[model samples]
Target: MYSGLMSTPERLIESTRELLWERGYVGTSPKAIQQHAGAGQGSMYHHFTGKPDLALAAIRRTAEQMRATAEAVLGGTGPAYARIEAYVLRERDVLKGCPVGRLTMDPDVIADDELRAPVTETLDWLRERLAAIVEEGCAQGEFTPGLDPQQVASTVVATVQGGYVLARSAGSPAAFDTAVRGLLALLAAARTPASAPAAS
Candidate 1:
């Protein structure tokens, strides 16, 4: 079915995304990409300069997708805490981990500016967006007045990233769930108690 209508370039980029997720930049090679894409060496080279060029295109597309997915939950209609909760609690591939987050551990990716910029920018965007949500929660009196948005935002991001590490180490999703629950509990505790109901 895939070979039915997919253009040469589209097939190349899609294959690159999956390969990059499964194997870092170092592990992925032009031949591997070609094999995975079911494209010829000339077909691949015809559309792009080389592996790096194709990979950069793949990474940029991935970054945009990540932001769009996050925004769907973060920007949805809900109380701030609810939105934050939804953002974190959204179902994820615990074993596979985050596609973008996984790139941080890739030596080849980190060593190359072209490969790393999208990763950094995507994560930075995530942090800024989360911080803005926290700030909104605070403004609406859902959080303690003294809470720091950026710090809390960073904590949330760290918890998810760290959760991935623990899950992989333990060979189960329990670690990821535990970490998320723990973070949510902390967020709940940070909420300012609602004022007592009006007296008679």
Candidate 2:
């Protein structure tokens, strides 16, 4: 009677991704995924042995999406400061910690190496991508001469993550805005003349 006819496996995986985004690893269940996907238990079992299996697939999908997003934000066609600012200023729902970052708070995810790998990889890619941009800015005389790209990149990532935590904790977006503005100011300072000393 199901006429729309998306493949059962695809539907299950997609449903798992959504549930993971909404409730996280421990909060998600096979029944929830099945109900969301409109698939039967037998179909889900045929596709995945259990929640962990489904979660692994979802985690990989999330990691891939994060990488693609970084590439889009950090690559090509602008001054490095402008590009970094663009990346940071992209609209986001601050109260919902980054989908990938939220996994770090889930105990079940931290306990499972397979699950943790994708989360770690996604964050690493983001930090390295941002660092590369900062390094480019330094080389172009657009940023402080001795700015530590790795440290700055780490702070940028941490600020975004911490902003989410603060927003979720405080039940408001004000903290998120405060954190973002502070970061923008730091980046602006990096672009000042002292940051880009004239050649000897």
The models' CA-based lDDT, in order, is 0.90, 0.85
Error of 1 at 66 (Å): 0.9
Give stretches of model 1 more than 4 Å off: 1-3, 195-200
The candidate scoring highest on TM-score is 1
In candidate 1, how many Å is residue 34 off?
Answer: 0.7
Compose the digit string of candidate 2's lDDT tens values, residues 17-90: 77887898777888888899899999899988888898899889988987888689789778787777777777
Q: Which ten residues in a row have the lowest lDDT in candidate 1?
A: 191-200
In angstroms, the error of model 2 at 102 is 0.3
Evaluate residue 62 in candidate 1 and report its C-alpha lDDT on the 0 to 100 scale: 89
lDDT of 1 by residue, 68-128 (tens): 9999999986777888889889989998989999999999889899899999999999999
Superposed on all Cα atoms, model 2 deviates from the true structure by an RMSD in Å of: 3.8
When summed lDDT is taken over every stretch of 10 residues in candidate 2, the lowest stretch is 190-199
Q: Which parts of model 2 are misplaced by more than 4 Å?
A: 1-5, 194-200
Question: Candidate 1 deviates by what RMSD?
Answer: 2.8
